[model samples]
Target chain A: MIVDEVDKQIILATQAGLPLVAQPYQAIAAQLDLTAEEVMQRMRIMQENGIIRRVGAVPNHYKLGYRYNGMTVWDVVDEQIDYLGQLIGQLDFVSHCYHRPRHLPEWPYNLFAMVHSKTKTGVTEKVNIISQELGEFNRQQEVLYSTRILKKTGLRIGR
Target chain B: MLSDFYMQLLNDYQQDFPLTPRPYLAIAESLGVSEDDVLLAMQELTDQTLINRIGTIIKPNKMGKSMLVAMAVPEAQLQRVAGIVSSFSEVNHNYERENRFNLWFVLMSSTGELLQDTLDEIEQQCGYSTMRLPLVADYFINLGFELDLERDQELDREPDNGCDRLSTN
Candidate 1:
């Protein structure tokens, strides 16, 4: 899905956030000299093409009482990684799950799942649930809790 | 504690937010609330720093290339190294975690070449080798977090959840 110049403009305009108004699309269209219908159409097309994952209210997990977040990395059997990864990803507690490459001798975990909870105990409980689901296939695992958010500015694409 | 109305606004609108002309009105109609009420609630939520934004969550590697990179910084130089890394616009979500590879962040660029260049520059400035871990497969279908307001209410009653003191920032 190639994002043309117009699409790029739309992304830049709304990436920060859609305006808080009765007719947000119209406001964006006005900025770009595009019709409201065209703006909505382009966005819809982008959404269908997987360019736009979703358009919604992004909540701050920390402010929402999810203070404890652990990036739980697992060294699962390679053969069953996709199957197991899918299973682990579907859990309600897990937010971002991905199969990443492991730098052996230094890093040995390939599967990473970010678990968030209101309490540290809650995070451990969620990890335990994942462990049970993995069972014998779960060879080793470690949870890296973030102590400080050094920087957290969300993605910014410049023109 | 969040009101039930606000909870509904947060829970239901996390994903599949209206793409219509009057999205707020649509939400108001669906939630059986006045459009102004919905608008005010959303504004209040944004003001409270609860709602980061009402916008699109772009898929990684779609508009540009991105990868999660980690570097092990000495405790003494952690702050300095993190400052250098975060100085680059490409690097977002820099965090100091509890591990040997303490400094972790995600880097994104419009092109692969630019992404590599940023990574190289970070290593040079920070004086530490970085572990570039790009996503091979994403298993999670992001449906947004399901907030359990009831559980949160229960937790509010507890004496200490370790994070009693909120940062003013």
Candidate 2:
């Protein structure tokens, strides 16, 4: 789709990220010589067009005191993946759950779920619950605890 | 140019970031301003490149397939690898990390095979072996950005998953 110059400018500015201010839109308005309403309208359009999925704050999981966060990989049966994933996702503790290629020789887990709890034992408990709930589809599982934390940034796109 | 009012507004976002259709009105009321003013400010911040996009923090599994892919792309051909990976519609976010298994990106697709095919295509196109580290479990803490600014807390790897699990609305 053909984006006008104003839309282009808004996209470019937000590529870096939205400013953290009470009137952040005002800051952008001054930069673009447009009204804050205009900038918002354009963003709404971009979001509607799938150019941007969301504009929001990403929470930091570590700082809030709860310490046990681990990635749980499961080798679930193919046919039951959809139903099993929905069931695993229903557990509030499972923050992220999805299916990726097992990549046999390289990677062996087909379905991955993130479990967070107050302790490693808690995470393991949740994993066990998921495993039991998985029924016949559950084949194998592993938890890769993070060894280091990396910087997380929002998506940046060029128009 | 964020004013004191803007700072106050951000504070509100950090404290009680409401999850509602007209969330801005609540913020405006908290700041003693009109909802139009809050909306206008947010638009300006977005335009100026300060705050990231404001939207829902989806509790994973609600959407399509999401996987973490890593590749051992030669330094000489890093940009090419990134280009090839980014070309795929499934590749939503990509970045280079300081590790032996360097190139890291997130692939979100409706089908697992489709995600694998895209990665295989990237491997063939970029001449690098990509490692897929799809998450099996996820834990989230309520540490908003406000804490980051206040504390120069280093984002390091720690083995603790005591995070609150709430579908906050």
Number of the predicted model whose TM-score against the real structure is largest: 1
The C-alpha stretches of model 2 lying farther than 4 A from their native spots are: A1-17, A32-34, A45-54, A150-159, B1-25, B28-67, B70-128, B132-169
Worst 10 residues of 2 chain B by lDDT: B160-169
What DockQ values do the models have? 0.59, 0.10
List where candidate 1 sits over 4 angstroms from the true fold.
B151-169
Question: How much is the lDDT of residue A77 in candidate 2?
Answer: 85
Evaluate candidate 2 and give its CAPRI docking class based on DockQ: incorrect
Candidate 2 lDDT, A51-112, residue by residue in tens: 54445543333433346666677888878777777777667677566767677764567777
* Candidate 1 displacement at residue B160 in angstroms: 16
- Per-residue CA lDDT of candidate 1, range A1-159, in tens? 799999978877877899999999999999999999999999999989887878888876666778888899999999999999999988988888889999998899999998889899999999999999999998899999887777767667522
